[model samples]
Every structure is written in C-alpha cells, then in structure tokens.
Target: MEKFTLESQFQITGIGSASGLVYKENSLFIISDNGSFLYQFDIPYNKLTRIPLVKNAQENIPKKDKYDFESIALKGNKLHIFGSGSTAKREKEITYNLETAATEEKDLSKLYKKIKQTATLSDEDLNIEGAIFFNEKWHLFQRGNGANSKNGIAILNDNFDEKGTIEFILIELPKIKHIETSFTDAILVENKIYFLATAEDTTSTYADGEILGSIIGRIDTQTMKIDFTQKITDINKFEGLTLYNKTQDKMEFFLCEDKDSEVLETTIFKLTLDIKHN
Candidate 1:
C-alpha cells in the first residue's frame, strides 16, 4: 500500500496550541487556538516572531473570550483565519492583509447556522477545523467532535459581501482504536485534498480528551472520496498542516501539534510521503 512516512520532525518553542498554519514567501504563519497573537517562523524553523492579533493586549486571551481560531488559508498576500464555531463567541471569520497590515473581522453566526441546517447537523456538531480556498470557493471542514460526530465539508461562495449559496458534503473518516477521527486541518495541492485529523476520546467540542493519535489522509476532489489514510503518530494531536516542498516522487509537509497543555511550547513536524499515481 502507498503511504506517507515521518522522515523528520522539529520543535518550535514559545508557541502553544498551534491550530492553524499557512506557508508563504519562505515563512510559516501560525495561529494558536487559544492565543492572543499570530506567529511567523522563518524557514528552517530558526527565527520566530509574534504579531498581536488583539491590539494593546499584554497577555493571552482568556479561554471563554478567545475566538478559538482553528483553521487558516492564504490567498495572495492575504491570510484568512476561521474560528471554530463551537460557541457563540467562536463565530468569527478574520482576514488579515499582509501588504497593508490591516485586519477585518466578520461575524459568521448566520452562516454557521445555515451550514448546520443544510448539513442536517445539530448545533453541537458544528466545529470547523480546516479551511482552504479552491476553485474560487472556500471549503470548510467541520470536525466531528460532538455528540452527532459528523464530519463533512461546507462549501461557501467566494463573494462574502452577500450571503451566497451553500452546500455540504458529509464524510466518514477512518477510526483509530475504536475512537472516531475528526478533521483538524488540511491543504490542497493539484486536485487532491490532504488533511490532518486526530482521534480525541470526547464527544463535546469544548472539552479536551485522550489523545489517541493523528492521521494523514488524502481525498480525490473530483470523486469526493478518500484515497488513502495512514496513522502518522501515536500521540500529539497535530492540528496544522502546510506544504513544505514537492517533487515528482516525493512530497514534504510541515505539521504543527497541539498537546493541550499549558507549557506554551508547540512542536512542528516534518513529514515526507511517496507520491503515487492512481
């Protein structure tokens, strides 16, 4: 069977709960799920810089007040960050322009509610953890970490100025040791969707649980079917994924982990896989 291998891994100190990742211009931009700042790391994981997401904030945002930014995507010089709509406070979408250093925020409460209705998902089952822009549309991955445990993709129209059409495609992910897997983050290259998912032994999106493991999966977007899935690690809930490099035979990715600890340090892993043709 064709599968990916963990060729290398590294640690990025001084960042915690790395839930979102985007790579551009030889730099990695990261967002912690519970932090008050955005982090930028130079290639080779050498230097680190923190950009305040909240102005004039001297400390990390409180858990209840934090936006719970979970997934991110990059388009040109702009970075789109999404909050995991697990609560009313998390119903936010943020756009950051790198060129002008300006940020815009929008309340996505209505959109999330519409997604729940369209997908037939209960209000408790709408935790969005992965996002990517493909074919001029925004694809949002909803984590199956609630009572209903429904994993799916919510497609939204590119024109965000007005409420455009919405669609949902539900998915069933491979399980780990009887525990269901849920989407954490994903990236798109060519026509394939590569995702990182974790198997947390919990039903509520608000609570953390046993870190069963993490998996790397691929889906053929044309068919809307999973191509392959392989466990990447036995521990460490990796919540962020971004392409590092790609060649004809091999593909490399950078993954970041969220241990759900208070240590204030996160690990960045380098993974390699054999590229196969179907």
Candidate 2:
C-alpha cells in the first residue's frame, strides 16, 4: 500500500492533549483527557474554542487523580465520553447533548461492582481506551499494561445499560517481551473495522512517551478476526481516529496524535485509504 501525506495538519491550540474527536459538518469536537475540556474547532479556518465538560476533572475524580479521556463516539444527537479515574475499576461513560450542552453522568459505580462480582473485570483490567459504535452495538477496547494479560476488546449494547448482562468478545495479543502494545482508537469503515494502536519497545505508561510508529490493523467484523496488520512509521502516539466520507470513492481518515510534551499540541492528519483493494 502507498501512503501520501496531506498538506493540511490541523493543530489544535489551547487544548493539552486530545484523546477523542467527533466531526460535525464544518466543526470538529475534541476532548482533552488531561484538562477535561471540550474543544470546538472550525474546520476550514482552524479556529478553536473551548467548553469545559467537567470542571476540575482532575480534582473532582474520586481520589483526586487524573485519567485519560480515551475515546468518544456520537450516536444521534448525543455524545458519549469514556474514561476512568482512581476509584474506578472500569471506565465510566458520560453522555452529553449536542444542542443543549447538558451533561449526565451514568453511575457506573454499581455497574463496576456488578461486573467485578461476576468476574468480568479485575482492578487491573479497567484501562479501557477505545470505543466505537458498530452493528447496533458499542465496542469498547481495553489496554493491558501489566503482565499475564494481552490487550482486549469488548462489545456492549447501545445505551451502555447492559454492562453486567453483556458478554464481551475479547481479542488477546501475543506475548512479546519488552514490547508494549495497546489499541488506541477505532472506526467502522465500509463494513470493515479499522483500528489504531501503538506497540512500543519501552514500557511507557504515558501516551506521549510511546515510540513513534504505525500500528494500524483491520478486523473482519463478520469473522471477528484481525485480518491484517501493518505498521505506519514516523507518526507519534496516535490517540483518536475517525473515517470521514467525502464521497463514494473519495473517503479520508482523520487521526489525532496526543503530543503533550514540548509544544503540547494535538496534530490532525488526513489520509486516503484503498478500501477496494483491501
């Protein structure tokens, strides 16, 4: 496959490091995991504005600790934000209205307890990082940074109410020494699941410290198998991705790399995919 870089790199300003992006017409909504701010940017002009979704997100967390926002998805007119804090055994999903901007937190504390009671998750398995809606279901992917476990992906029903009732389909990675791999983000494109991930030689917990490389893969939803795996190099720690339909044959993929250090900028890159051949 050939890769051609686009000219435009949308650099999001005022936001620390964005983990999620949802596009609406000419505007792009981004979620900052560190700052807990929701940013809206005008596409063409690249003008940016911010709206705080959870004020004092770091301090307000159960134990006054920080967590990554991870991933976001839009269903109808509502937006869902997923993340985990110090007290959470699993990530919590928060919903917000697009028009009204009103927010509601789904009390997943009970759900987390229920899942733990049934042995669905352990304290270490709570690092959920990617979420996407597909085939009338929401698929959540969790990253594994500890030993004796590979990264996993779980599918959930819509509304996220079937936490304990739902059976998660898990994908386990092969054990590789000194290499840390985790799924970052995902998008459904033309009946195929395109996922973004990172595999680093060093055991870095922070997103910005991960080694720069391409960890793109495709999953066959019908067979539920990872059909292809390829590496894209030079790109930094990619956190969020989405497929944008420009036309029937003219589709593009937008991805965000969370570079928190130095410039502390989130970079957006546009890429064209060859779906017909894949």
Choose the strongest candidate by lDDT: 1
Scored by lDDT, model 1 comes in at 0.85
lDDT of 1 by residue, 31-74 (tens): 98887577888866589988776666323567778888899899
Query: Model 2 segments beyond 4 Å from truth?
Result: 1-8, 56-64, 85-90, 113-121, 162-164, 172-180, 201-209, 246-250, 260-264
Which 10 successive residues of model 2 have the least lDDT summed? 58-67
**Candidate 2 C-alpha lDDT tens digits along 1-278:** 53434434686656666677887888787776665666788988879876666655431233235545777888888888877421452246677788899887665666445433343556544556677787887777766543324466666567666443655566754322356456778777767887877755543333234464656677888987887765654546677777766454445778777665424467777766554545
After best superposition, candidate 2 residue 162: deviation in angstroms? 5.4
Q: Which ten residues in a row have the lowest lDDT in candidate 1?
A: 52-61
Q: What are the lDDT figures for the candidates, one per model?
A: 0.85, 0.64
Best by TM-score: 1
